[model samples]
Target: MLPKSILEHTLVLDIETVSAAASYAELSPTMQKLWALKAEALQRRLAEEEKMTAADYYPEKAGIYAEFGKIVCITVGVFTKNEEGQYKLRLKSFYGDDEKVLLQDFSAMLSKYFQRRGQQYVCGHNIKEFDMPYICRRMIVQGLPLPAPLQIYGKKPWELHHFLDSMTLWKFGDYKAYTSLKLLCGLFGIPTPKDDIDGSQVGRSYWEDGDLDRIEVYCKKDVFATAQVLLRFMLEDPLALIFESADG
Candidate 1:
């Protein structure tokens, strides 16, 4: 049982990722030849050098691994209350395969949804910082045109007329410099899903197992969490949602 304002719009979001690519050395032909000639020498030198730390290990030709560059999976989930006044989960769209097709489909789907529901809002957890920026970069890379509705770079931080960040709302006032969706879900007594997959396993899943479905499910769970946060923010939270008293 929520007011109309809270159930007025839907939230759409997605994520992209790339798996372990060649290390910096493997990319350079000169370094490749060096490795070929002096494997032991290089290993010993690397072992001694601070740069050779375990953190520097990179999978060999892992496959187009880019930091905040390519998108691996795009999961879009929508939240709306049906006639019965019960919140429902609608996976509006889930696209993950070729990066180009995914982005195009994502943009098209968003455009269509916005066109039909002109005034609805779109939201996600940390979308402003990660998902949106990553998607934009991929679009630019593929030279695919971004639909008018998906053009979000021009909007101001607090002036997201059509987009909202669930994380932002949850971390009001003393908003921490870091807040993971999982962490916030825990604080709010929401059950965060536990799966064997994470961003780190994405590349392996994509290449070895070709299990985009798992990734899609993972992304959907995130969207569900985001929707839950929005629900709590706009209705369940007494501090945020002001309800009329029975006496009134």
Candidate 2:
């Protein structure tokens, strides 16, 4: 595997999201409308799931998967080598309150990082198909500008000068089936996060109690897991893409 020094320019990111919802029956007309739309989307998604599990591919269903919900928050944790050869992660979170402002802040941070280092990459679990696109879409939704590095699509996956998705790397060959972050963590023997809270529960926590701290903690744990998986890739030398390759 490549030495840790070679990966000094990589950043690990993870995010949390919550959709618009109302807890009690009495709600404003605007919220009622948003809730209705979200509910309809959820029902269609459930139907699609049943059909998809039966070997049916539905384009509309895939679209639902893509556009079901909007991002509520994004937490990015950047890891790099210190002078002492130890990895340190610095973290920041963008709460989706005033999404435009948050996205602008995020873009500014990316710009600052790139200018400071000249080159850096994003490394995350399932980032290519999910997290990266979600961030881009959220930015677009807010009508905020995106930095050039964030627009890394349409290039050869291996030719990407920056950005690496751990799930993509793990799927170096076989990618026919879905593999989750939790599953890969188990394979690498990385301790998974405590299950007291999960992605599904975050939305409830956010809408019901306005719990940003819990969501931040959950996001950090995901970032930590993502970092651990990347460490295993760079240091453990267990996977074929690493141990068996000349690059190692």
TM-score of each: 0.72, 0.73
lDDT of candidate 1?
A: 0.59
Where does model 2 exceed 4 Å of error? Answer: 21-68, 82-84, 115-118, 153-161, 236-248
lDDT of 1 by residue, 41-158 (tens): 3356554553342224333222222332357677766655566666665664445566788788778877776653246777888776767766776788789887765676667765
Query: With candidate 1 superimposed using the best TM-score fit, by how many Å does residue 182's alpha carbon deviate from the native?
Result: 0.8
Summarize candidate 2's per-residue lDDT along 63-157 as a digit string, tens digits: 22324345556677666546665666666677654556767877887887754322677888877778778788877776777787776557676
Highest lDDT scorer: 2
> TM-score winner among the candidates?
2
Q: Residue 22 error for model 2, in Å? A: 4.1
